[model samples]
Target: MESISITPTIINPKRVFKKTTGEEWYNYYAGFSDDFVSEILNSFELPKDSVILDPWNGGGTTTLNCALAGYNVIGIDLNPVMNIVAKSKFCNTDDVLMALDIVKYLRVNNYPNKLNDESDFLLNWFDYNTASYIRYISFSLQNKCNTILNSKVFSLIFLALFKLVRKYIGKFIPSNPTWVKKAKNSNDKISIESTKIKIDLKNILREKLSATFVDNVSSIGKERFYCASSTKLPLKEHSVDAVITSPPYCTRIDYGIATSPELAVLLGNHPAEIDNIRRTLTGRTTIDKSFLEIESLGLTAKKMLLEIFNHQSHASVSYYYKNFAQYFIDINESLKQIKKVLKRNGYFACVVQDSHYKEIYCDLALIFTEMAEENGLSLIHRQDFMSKFVMANINSKVKKYRDKITANETVLIFQAN
Candidate 1:
């Protein structure tokens, strides 16, 4: 099938990932599709030496697409789990098989790899045996075998562990798939049969991870992803040729809580570890006690903030107003960082949606345009597609706040001045 040369009419803006394979490693509640990234790359007809950057590299959709297209890509995310996941894309059969050989060894020997990382978070969310098995697999994957398994191989194994853990912790995940709750009911014993899981794990990892994606590593510019914050970027000044990223929306989504299960299963099992990450992210729910008054957030943000402050809805002034203020603050700082890294005349495309604080409209697209311009990014093009499905539409109670069934997903294209 021939690829769409022209950027398609925006549907959900974030996926239909089935169009591309191997990206189904993790289900992201807030990630754009590979098809969308392909269109952006094609439509822009970027320079041959162009280096792509996905600042908010949720689930590796942008980074993976860039790799397939043979562009040098860098994917960054604050969540450590995402870095492990993004790197998994770089793995081939050799890398995956090596990790599997280690797994085979561990299983055959019955490695008593206990979950010495006594985790209250896991205890509240998962059955002891289930969590222990997951921890054991993760620890084994992280082991130093013959000068330490290559980053790609370890990441592939870690991704496999995530797949296994997701099946056993079904009871904790709520209506919103991202939101994982604590303390399963005693009646609801979601126990994993160790024998069945071993079979499932082998089948899942072997079939998925062994398949090759990138045809030639030498032919293409390499992809590098890191567990880094977007606000404080790791790239050098004027290093990036283009930035293709969808910054977190101002909807106050807790990105940290969304990936709590992955964080608990692999990196850190403490709730504070999760909360600390949440506090650092751009669109996270937590608030700072000594919040800085941001003057550079632009006129559009100020007006929206004022409207939310005066709104009559419950908690509109106290909680909702403050939440949006912090988002704009972080976003303002991020735009500045983006401008610093983008080469002159380079392209920057951002996908954003409008939200509501009760009846007050938070025109995020307009706000972002203003903020980007303030940071030396000149607006070149803009397209708004009415999104049939949005996060707000999922909640029945949202109808009371606004009768509108859908939101507009605006793609703002800009050039670095």
Candidate 2:
């Protein structure tokens, strides 16, 4: 049969609701449609119990859909919180009731404790009483690990608090655009009110519990999620039948910092661990400027990096150069690991978006194809779909490096050579 090129018509974003209970729990910043994943997986003529792999499972869309389709799936992500979130979606009805019971217990017995020493991120983003309540909740959840709900159930509560804090605080001040915590001006400090802080945490917690405990939800198959880097996949050779995932963008959107508030709630005591995880993510903004060594880059990626390095005239030119070089290098390393795990003739599909640095367009799909070919994978098909407005500052009037950047989502499929 002749090779076919899948088009945008094959994808329908509204199909995310097809698995309402599974998809509803976790909505990370970078996520794709569940239908998109289903279409790609269905294209291949694989057995029902094939083992599928998702290296960069941002919001667990690939893993969730695969489980619902009755395939065994392994999802790996560097984000600790997301690892639990992905695994939690596969929880049974008994697990949901257990999570609800835990939430109820915490609500009635736990009292807001005075937070004497909290992280600055928490202090700035949450008001005093809000921070205290979060501390209280975290304290209470930690104490009841043996009986009520396992660590995973505790994560559900932590994630709920994480969502509620951001929801209410966002009403006060918009999230900082950059990764670093910039010095807030005087007027920004005055906007947070104590009454706003007192927004019923119990009510929000119960609502989250209700949403998680759907009427009739069942796990399709055995699914596992691991907190591991994509560059170093810990799987046996030729083990997985198919690999499907969406790698992070090279546009310097700090995945760690974007989810830092959640991390703050989860790992408030472990500041060093938080920083280490941030530094280890694929396209983190804080690159080591002194370390200028570029990894194994394909011809297309090298050309793009050099062009961006030469053309970039922004204030943070050095940082941009490092970020571009590091992203491709990391991706190339990850592709090699992916090839090691995929069986002969196994399919590899990636959902990526094109990005812009200054005026230069980073054709991520083309660059990724080059990397895949270098690592002995043959391109089978490419599909382009109109993505939502997730680009950086596309609508803003500011003339930043990432402003006015736009592109469609491209799915590049490859088969093992």
Off by over 4 Å in 2: 1-9, 12-23, 107-120, 146-152, 172-219, 289-295, 315-317, 388-390, 395-405
Q: Can you tell me which runs of candidate 1 are displaced by over 4 Å?
A: 1-12, 19-23, 108-118, 145-150, 209-211, 216-218
Per-residue CA lDDT of model 1 for 304-394, tens digit only, reads 8888788887887778888888889888888999999998877888899888766678899999999999999988778887878767766
How does each model score on lDDT?
A: 0.75, 0.70
Report lDDT (Cα) of residue 31, candidate 1.
72
Superposed on all Cα atoms, model 2 deviates from the true structure by an RMSD in Å of 4.4
Per model, state how many residue pairs clash.
Answer: 1, 0
Residues forming the 10-long window of minimal summed lDDT in candidate 1:
1-10
Candidate 2 local lDDT, 217-299, one digit each (tens)? 45475677778899999899999999988888777877777777677676665667889888999888778645555546777
Superposed by TM-score, candidate 2 places the C-alpha of residue 228 at a distance from the truth, in angstroms, of 1.0
Best by lDDT: 1
In order of appearance, the predictions have TM-scores of: 0.90, 0.83
